[model samples]
Target: IGLSFVPDLKLANSLYALGSCYNTIALIYTKLSDHLRALEFHHNALAISKRIDNRRSVAQSYNNIANIYQDLEDYDSAMVYYERSLALKTEGNDRAGMASTLNNMGELMLATNRLNEAEKFFLESLEIKSESGNRAGEVYTQNNLARLALLKKDFPGAEQYLDITERTAQELGLLDELRVNYELRIALLKELNRPADAFRYSELLMVVKDSLMNREKAEALAGIQIAYEVSERDRQIAFLEKEGELRKSQLALRNTLIVVSLIILGLVYLQFRREHRNKEQIKTLLREMYHRFKNNLQLLSSVLSLSARELTDEQALQAVRSSESRVNAMALIHRKLFERKDEARSINLRDYITELITYLIHAYGYHERGIQTDLSLEPVQVDIDKAIPLGLIINELISNAFKHAFIDHQSPCLTVGSKLEEKATLNIEIRDNGVGMRPPAERRGESFGLKLVNMLMNELRGKYEVSTQSGTRYVLIIPL
Candidate 1:
């Protein structure tokens, strides 16, 4: 019906509406678990969204397609779609959408038994949900956390998470989340050898299931009623159109068009002036926002530093410091943007990386350890989206080297280099003159740092290779 209203199918509004319709149908099929049909509609939605230049819809289509792939157990495909969705959402600064995609990715990681990676994604989602005051989303993440804890055999931790989730889910009237909480509760009780409690939860689970079925039936009936009403409204419109056949005078139409054109021209001139002022205002606001963001990150880094200082366990302190470094890396990007006086969105990679290495050197006490630094980088500019993740990747590689790669080396040296290859790819090398590091395959199931690196690499659509012959040499190839 919406398509019929469009006299020209090539119009932007028509294409955007068609994309929305496709998205709606795709989501409906997704809920029905019809993977083939869902993917077909989602791909159509994605194509139309791209044609209309509707980025938000494109991100949503990607996320919906990822959900279908995940249901079909195509994890690799799901991950790729999820990453694309996340990148687009991040570009738009859509925090709510980002949280949703993060939660879905966390579930994918959990299903694959990458527990540590799952926890990180879950925590990230939870943090965003909490900050956005999304109580329902926060409860859902807590339930995921409970499931994660159960998998790790941390019964007490699982119970703590379930307790919070159950209470919050009920408070929020989140039926789906409450059902999930009940299911996890039953599992937790079974693991604890409390058959009676497990059985009690099983009964409650059935009641919730029945309630959900009734809610679904109600929604289905409502949809049917809406369809009937729309049909009747269309018939009435057709009847009214047949009854009244008034025609307009061609002279009046021509006069109206001339007046409308004059009005549009005047509005266009006013719009031009308004847009210029708006652009200036937006730039000023962006700089101020960047400054605030950088300051907030610095405050977070300080808190992490203070927390690390208070920690007694070496491993725990090191973990806190690693997190602090990651925060610092992200903060650096915003700081650069804040300091830049131009409207250019790209940051000079040479200056950014050189300053980053210098900070890391002091932060890790490379000088105190008699460690030598070698920095070689060609001038390249990257937008904030790529810069933040690249900065984190560099931080992790260099920080890992400083902490572990130089355990017993007499003459420690770190080499950080980057160069543009044929004006197409950016080749980055981080090498150390210390003990060789383990390959990704060996530490794939462990190492939070490596998990983060893999995720960031995916975000950048980059490839990497590790050589452990002389020491640890990480060669990252990122397309420009």
Candidate 2:
């Protein structure tokens, strides 16, 4: 604030340095438990960091923001920032930074209900730290790993990590870490039924905590007092140190943003070149995926195509065709998701179902088969955790109707409707008017596909109901 009106300051450099200063102030405020103030400064830092062209700095800014969000228990925002940090770390080949990002990501996952995924991420990060010989980071990850194991009730695993952490902390003379380790060791011992050892370690941990707190308060107080005599010179020195720290962050941010912006901007110029190159790579990958999907479809199709090949009896061919339509229905959903965006997870069900219906119509080529999709939503998005299995379930019901209900010159038409019943519950309905089941037990309630759908529905904790009014109507409601 005192230097705010420094008329001679270079705008770009000062703006950059100002951001760094804000970051340092934020860090100090954070340790003081003044998170709101810390966040304010961090926001200031981000504002300036974004003004410059520095990818690394932009990433660092994101990390700082994430750290605050995490402290606030805003895990979703924390994970987002952590991912942004990871992307930047990858682009810059910042191994240490990457490890830190991974650690943070794992921590966020652990906070959520993703225990197994959290463990995997934590272990992956631990490996990275160990390989890079970043012992401090290893200690941190180990501490978290130990905590997670304890939460999971794996006392032995928790103890193993705590023992490793203690050794590393001792080597580094990190008293705070040692204090935390002692606390954990005591807890682990208690959990393991070693009462005497737990009691002993608990006493030691208390002693360590008291000593560490005393030492920290004493050192900080003494350091403050010592500066009093040389206050004028020390004030200048403090200003310089603060300025230096700020300048470093500013320069780092500027350099990073500039470099990144240039690289991204340059890519725009080489769009044709990059796309030309990427086109080949994308085609190779997509073509490979298409071939794999086609192969699987072909295998099922071959079993059904037996009549043409004159290899199997009519009954067998009919069974094969039933299986083929079901497989194709599932395949159509996959094709919708894959052909649109990412393939690993999640998709827009409405669009996917729409595309699927189009494919089904073209395949069956039934002129009277008018398909109407009534979605109680503009678009329905669901993760593959629920979507893939649910999609398959829908496919089975629709295919069964296509093969059995609307059969032998029957007017075959199906209506598929999906919507959210609540914030967490999704409702899907498949109805056909061609033919309704006379009795629920007519199908004998047995088939691999139906069994799979039942198992998945059970796993997803959903309720499925089947009814025959004018036609067959199957209703499924799944909790997210």
Error of 1 at 206 (Å): 2.4
Report, for all candidates in order, the number of backbone clashes.
0, 7
Model 2, 13-74: lDDT tens per residue? 56665665677678878999898888887877777777887778888888888999999998
The C-alpha local distance difference test score for the whole of candidate 1 amounts to 0.79
Q: Report the Cα lDDT for residue 211, model 1.
A: 61
Q: For candidate 1, lDDT tens digit of each residue in 1-480?
A: 323323323333446655665766677677787889989988988998888788998899899989999999999999999999999999999999999999999999999999999999999999999999998789988999999999999987898898778666654456678789989999987886656347546755766676668656755665565556555654655565567642223222332333334435645754565445434544554466567678878999999999998999999989999999988988888888889996445688989888888788788887676778788988888866468779989999999998989987889899989998985899999999888977767764768998889988986789999999889999999986
Q: Evaluate all candidate structures by whole-model CA lDDT and list the values in order.
A: 0.79, 0.68
| TM values, all candidates | 0.49, 0.46
lDDT of 2: 0.68
All candidates: CA RMSD in angstroms?
19.7, 21.0
**Clashing residue pairs in candidate 1 (N, C-alpha, C atoms within 3 angstroms):** none
lDDT of 1 at 302: 97
What is candidate 1's TM-score against the reference? 0.49
